[model samples]
Target: MSDYLEMSLEQLQKEHAELLAFNEKLDRERNGYRKYAMKYAKKVQMIESLFVVPSDDHELTIKAIKTIVERVGES
Candidate 1:
């Protein structure tokens, strides 16, 4: 192989490896975000189930608001 061709091949291989590493890092971040989203969804679902009332009462609405405020404050 010519000297120039060998050098070019090495550079390409290095770039390929860097791209692969970057892609893996992105995959890890995406997975983490997915897990966090699922957790947040579950928390919201729980809160809704706990506070949702059958009647449209102002006091009940205020209580729900307070509950949410307390929950957020704890977090």
Candidate 2:
């Protein structure tokens, strides 16, 4: 913050522009992940619906699906 205060107008302007560009890039990436999460959630819901019977196997399957999705997102 002190560095910015000492910077000339042109330097500050350039720094501001660079920061804005980086922020936009982050926003784009965040939006992409949000879309992916929504799609994956919908798919999980569909799979859950397919298993009408409530049993240990069904619970395990759902847990497995959630874990896989989480791992994939991390990658």
Candidate 3:
């Protein structure tokens, strides 16, 4: 009877160990998605800088800004 109870306990522990390992794999996949999202966000920020005015082109900068606003509004 003692041996039977010990075997049952060992089986339960093994199943629990498998579940913990699967959870870790899922956590890793979720972190990978978060890293990709951060990369995309950085790219968007770089692209948005095209709308900023440099010191040399006052009129052209105004026009570019207007065009950017219009395009953004259309989207």
Candidate 4:
């Protein structure tokens, strides 16, 4: 007789296998995001290279550039 709060042996094994598979998929997705983050950082650096700040409003230009860089992923 199975206890009310206990899973059957087969069900328990199947759930364990499913959870393992899900965790593996999550790991792969995490790695992909890591790669993408690196790529995004490089792209931000490249774009920043093209930015020109006038001597008169250097601080304003810097603020604008920072905003643009932070918003790269939204577009």
Model 3: ten consecutive residues of lowest lDDT:
66-75
The reply for model 4, stretches above 4 Å from the true place, is: 1-4, 50-75
| lDDT for position 53 in model 2 | 68
Q: How well is each residue in 1-75 modelled by candidate 4, as lDDT tens digits? A: 445358978887877798899999999999989988976887677566656433577787677677767776655
Off by over 4 Å in 1: 1-7, 55-75
Alpha carbon lDDT of each predicted model:
0.71, 0.78, 0.68, 0.75
Candidate 3 is scored at a TM of 0.53
Each candidate structure's TM-score, on Cα atoms with residue i matched to residue i, is: 0.59, 0.66, 0.53, 0.53
Model 1, span 15-72: residue lDDT tens: 7798899999999999989987876676577567765556568687668756764574
lDDT of 2 by residue, 1-75 (tens): 558778999998999999999999999999999988887886677567656766677678778677766664454
For residues 18-52, what per-residue lDDT tens digits would candidate 3 score against the true structure? Answer: 88999999999999898877766655564468656
Q: lDDT at 46 for candidate 1?
A: 59
Q: Cα lDDT of model 4 overall?
A: 0.75
Clash totals, every prediction: 0, 0, 0, 0
